[model samples]
Every structure is written in C-alpha cells, then in structure tokens.
Target: MDDERLRPTQLPLNDLATAYVQAGQTLFLAILDDIAARVRLAHPEAAYLEIGIDADGDVELHGIWSAQESAIGTCRLLYDPHDDPEQEWRDGPLDLDELVDDLGRVLTGSFLHHWGVVEPHPVYEHRDRRWLVLPPADRAATVAAIVRGHVPDAESLICRFAERGERIAVGFEQVTLSGGGTISVPCPLCSPETEDGPWPRDVSHELARILGQLYALPHLRGRHLTPCVDITAEHEGQLWQLVFPYRDHKKGAESS
Candidate 1:
C-alpha cells in the first residue's frame, strides 16, 4: 500500500481505540474485584489492583498478588491511535470496525495475565512477541507451566519481588546465558529513597538460592541453559553486583 493509504484517515478511529481500551480495562477491574473479595476474606488488608495510564496513551496494568504483597508484576500495553499498525492502513484504508476488533483482542489477551487471573502467555524466547489471545478464566498448573510448551535453549528470566504494596522492591535476574551473551539487570524499584540504598546481604543470597533451586527443576531444564547468576542491587549511592556460580544439583553443581 502507498504511504497515504497506510495512514488512518478518520479521527473516529481514535475514539474506537479509546473504547477498546476502556472496555478491556473495565473487564480487568471486575476480575480484580473478585480477587480482592476472596483475598480479603482471609486477609482483610489484602493488596488490590490498580491501573495507570500515561499521557502518551500507554496503559500499565500492575498490582500486588497477595495480602502481604509478596508478588508484584506489571504489563504495559500500547494504545496510541497514531502509532504503527494503528496508523498504517493494512490491506485497505483502516476499517474502524476491524481496528476495534484488533484492539479488543490484544487487550483481552494480555490484561489478565498481570493480575494472575490467567497463566502467563506461552511465548518467552523472543523478547518482543505478542502472545496468542487466550479466553478468559483459563487456569493452569503453575505460572511456569504457561510457558512449559516452549522450551528455549537459552533464556534470561527477569523476576521481580516486591512487598508492602510496592513501597519495597527486590528484583532477581535468573540468567542461563548462552552463546557468550552478557546481561545486566536493572532494579525496577528506582526511587531516591531506594536508589543507592542497599538491601541486606542475606536477602540477596536467599533470593539467589531460591531462584537457583526453582530453575534447576527438570521441567525448566534446557540444553543451552547454563548455571550462572549476576545479581544487581542499588543502595547507599552505589550499585552492588553479585555473581553466584551455579552449583550442579549433584557433584560439581556450582561449576555447571
């Protein structure tokens, strides 16, 4: 298609984008409400879901997964009408109806996973892959099992832990670096108070030990997956880097 044809001509399409995002957000909030009810029954002070929309029209879905706020996750979705695919009229001049359908599909597929309402999407190898849109209420064995279908040869799983409703954040980069690639994981919880603020040494060691054990399982095993961990923590006006060599489950485990 020509450049002109690639551009969406109607402003109404922008409204359509807004509608899709709104509908998705509504559905997402309802699901979270149910979660809060169940969680509060046992822990009346349970953490609740919250939504944030930036000026650029990007939607951020984030919240704590427990009363103690042990697990924290966020998923960002793009909904700018002027952006590509939204602007680039595909096949023909953009059809508002079709655009709305596309927007709905993308939103529905992703908004739930962050809330733990559904399993994390299956695709993980690629850093930028749009996962298949799954139907609502589809449960799974474990969050890890969601991607068990795809066993990647080499993977860098960025896991974050937060407590006390995001006031405190701890992140771990569990890497099985392959093909001589290097990675540096930045702390997501970056604030003046948190910056240069050191997390205790014991907490770092404990997190590393737990992650090492988790990924060492048979289901998570990969041929190219090596056992090496580089942990980063920011505190006291400095960034701390810790290297934990993977120990093999049997003899020579750490050297593996």
Candidate 2:
C-alpha cells in the first residue's frame, strides 16, 4: 500500500489551534502553537509547507519548506521503549490526560534522535529539536498534569504558586466543574487593565503548549485542570485562591 494513501493529512498548526480554541479545550494557546512548530522540526524530511496566521490574523508562515528533506533519506527517527509514540496525536482530539501522557513521551524521544545521529546530517542541522527531548505529544501531557493538578479518588490538586504575571482575567468568580469538582483559579490577565483580553501570542515551550491546548479542550469546560500559581505578593495582595477539583470548593468562587 502506498504510504501516501494511508498517510494522514497534517493540519496546519495555527488552524488546528484555532479549531481547538473554538471548541474550548485549548488550555494554553501559546504552548499549543509551539508544539506545532516542534512537529514541523521533527519531520523536516517531509517536503510540506506550512502557513501560520499572525495576531492581526494575517498569514505568517505560508510557503515555508522544511529544512530536513535532503538528509531525511539517511536520517531516521529514533525509537525507544521508554519513548512514547507521538504518531498517535497527529489529528488530535486530545484531552488533558492524553496530552500529558504524550508530552512525557516526546521528552524522552529527544534522546532517541540524538543517539541515532551517527553521520551528521545537514538537512535538519538548524531544525528545532526541542521536542527531541520529549516528543511534542508527550511534552503537552506532562505539563498539563503539572499545572492542571489531578484527581485521585476524593482528593484534588490546584496550583498555588506560578511564574505568571500578565495574561487574561475572565473576571474574579469561583466556578464549578462538571463533576462537582470545584476550583477557584484567578485569571488575573483577563481584566482589561491587565491584558488585552485575547492575550498576544508567544513561542512558549512545546510541552507547555500541549498543556495549553489541553486547557483549551472543549471537554475541559469549567474544568480548572491547570493550577495557577497563587500571587501572594505583599504588594499584589494575597491571592488565596487555589481550589481542588473536588466537591469541597468551587472554582473562582471564594472558598467558604
């Protein structure tokens, strides 16, 4: 069978990310875009071009050819038992858990890529192999799990300290999850004074972007998976707003 026949059509990363945001499961937009970029770097051998739209919604990366095509004839993707298979997330209906799992694999795969490089290949010499340490797929999953906390039976988790400052603040209100798991995370950057609502984009970590995508997943509606680092700065005022996804506290809702 011709591989092309079975070859799945790759969706443009920006388009895919937009689709995810529209769907509501994209937890982190910047992070997801970075992941897409990593994918482009990995499969440099494939002679496919990509187009990315800018913030003004203008096309940014159109008609761009990969840099690894020439060396791909001799280059090979390193595989490891410890490495998670990133091929599974090509089309992606990726959820929080799935994203975390895949990110972990991608991190491990970087070693595989390095070890396989016996004769130096110039095609991908300048390629971004950030995900070589962790495939784009696994990097997302791991980060999602960290920021989004977890639920083990009755106990739940939330982030109390984060290295974040300016983003989007969707109003200060505790929200509830679909499963009665409530959490109160502060969207400090959501406020008009703080952020421009639709925060500008940046090239964040590939795995971090995967978590961001999980955060945006439609299935994660009102689900505070990513934990926010509580801004307890004396000048900033005490942001005692970390809630677990359990029946105990409500998200954004002040803990009683």
Candidate 3:
C-alpha cells in the first residue's frame, strides 16, 4: 500500500478532533455537575464555587455560602494526571467523595469564619456552557508569570511601551484545533502619542504566540478543562484580554 494513500484525510482528522473535544467537554461538565450537587448537599446555603489548580498540581476547591454573613472555605486535593490513563485530560480526580468530605470539614470548622467576604467572579454564558472569569488581579499575575517565563523579552518591551505612554495588548480572540486561530492585539502605533515612535511588532507577535500556548498548560486548566472564559492582564497601563482555543485530548494530551 502506498504510504500517501494510507494517510488519513483532513476531514477525517478534523472529525476525530471534534469527537475528542466533545468527549472531553462532556466528561468535564458531568464532573462539574457532580461537584455542585455534592457541595450543595453539604452546605445548602452554598451559592458559588471555584476550583483552581496550582503549579504543583494541587487542586483547591473553594465554596461560598451566604446567610446574614458570607463565609468561604477551601479544601485541597491531590490530582495526578498519570494515575489514570483513561482520563488523563481531566484536571481533577474522578472520585468526589474525598473532595466533598474535605470541604465539609473546612466549612464546619472555625477557619470558615476567619476569611473575609467572598465575592463570586462574573460568569459568562456561551451556548450551553458557562465559565467563570478569574479576578483581574489573579489574571494579571498569571499572564505576567507566563509571559516572563516563556517570552522573556516581552517584559522589557512592555515596560518600554509603558514608559512611552504606549500600550501593547496581546490576546486571542478565538482558536480552533483545525487551525485559523485569531490573536487580538490593539496597534500601539495607532495611538496619537505613539505615532512619533516605532512599534515593536516583533514583541507583540511573540507575546501572542506565547499566549496561545496557555491552552496546553495542564496546571492552568482547572477541573472544567477550559481554564477560564477570559484571561486579562494590565501592567503600567498595558492591558490584555486573551481567549485561547479550547484544547481537547487530541492535541493537548499529546503535547502534555
């Protein structure tokens, strides 16, 4: 058989990608529903929940309940993707019993009252899916860490742009596995004050490239699979709002 003839066509590849994405999305949503049910049962007043994974692969679940006073409690869980080959793309464990117990203990303990008022992050609806946006401070910190770690030169260029009163914004408007992703960066030179100086298109492009890679970072992707609905950053007047392509096991798993 000819090697070229044996190769899969683009349509088949695309179909495979779509199927993989749907599978991951379905499993993720099911897990979210389970978590919500478990948490609500323990704390009937629980109105909001946020799950986050840190660089060390530790999973933290935070639940908030409102009565005359608002209270927040956090519980940590271990998540090792290597433990389950069948569900490697998932961010947390398939089991929720341990997680629920942990949250229950914390919410009932004295620690719950110490934490100040807890505010829920804004939620955005897209089709049948709803995702929470990270707080601006957290989002900015994460973006800065990613850019500095991946694209070192971006930090300095951003600083220079800030000094000159020019802002550089790098973000993704959309990304798809089949390819034609859109990266959004407002033109710094277009600003009246920046017209007198040169714009560093190279740095902007590099920043955009690095931002696109976020979809593949396992630690960043929470239990929801999609990290957040939007990631925005601001440094000395420079602001960025990034929305990367959804990554499924088809590409994300291979990269990981």
Please tell me which predicted candidate would have the highest TM-score against the true structure: 3
In model 3, what lDDT does residue 112 have? Answer: 21
Model 1, span 1-256: residue lDDT tens = 6766635646778667766654554454444434434434433433332333346544343322222223464333322234365645421332434433433443445554433334333336522322322221211122222222222222334454332221223354433344545444334344323433123434444344333322322232233224433244443222222223332358746666
TM-scores of all candidate predictions against the true structure: 0.22, 0.23, 0.27
As for lDDT, the candidate ahead, 1 or 2, is 1
lDDT (10s digit) by residue, model 3, range 1-256: 8766645677898777766644443343334334555544544444454544346544455323333242463322223224466854443323454764443433332222212112333334312221221112223344554544433333222221121111122433222222333323344544524432222545445444333222222343342133233333432343323332222448756887
**What Cα-based lDDT does every candidate model obtain?**
0.36, 0.34, 0.36
lDDT of 2 by residue, 1-256 (tens): 7766633545566566655434322223333344445444544332322323245433222222333436444334321112245654432332323433444433332222222211222347434222222223333334334434432232332322222222111223233354666544334454434432121223122323333333334343234454445443422422222243233346436654
Q: By summed lDDT, which 10 consecutive residues of candidate 1 come out lowest?
A: 134-143
For all candidates, the clash counts are: 12, 51, 0
Stretches of candidate 3 above 4 Å error? 1-9, 50-52, 66-97, 100-256
Model 3 residue 122 lDDT score: 37
Off-target runs (Cα >4 Å) in candidate 1 are: 1-9, 42-108, 114-256
Better of 1 and 3 by TM-score: 3
TM-score for candidate 1: 0.22
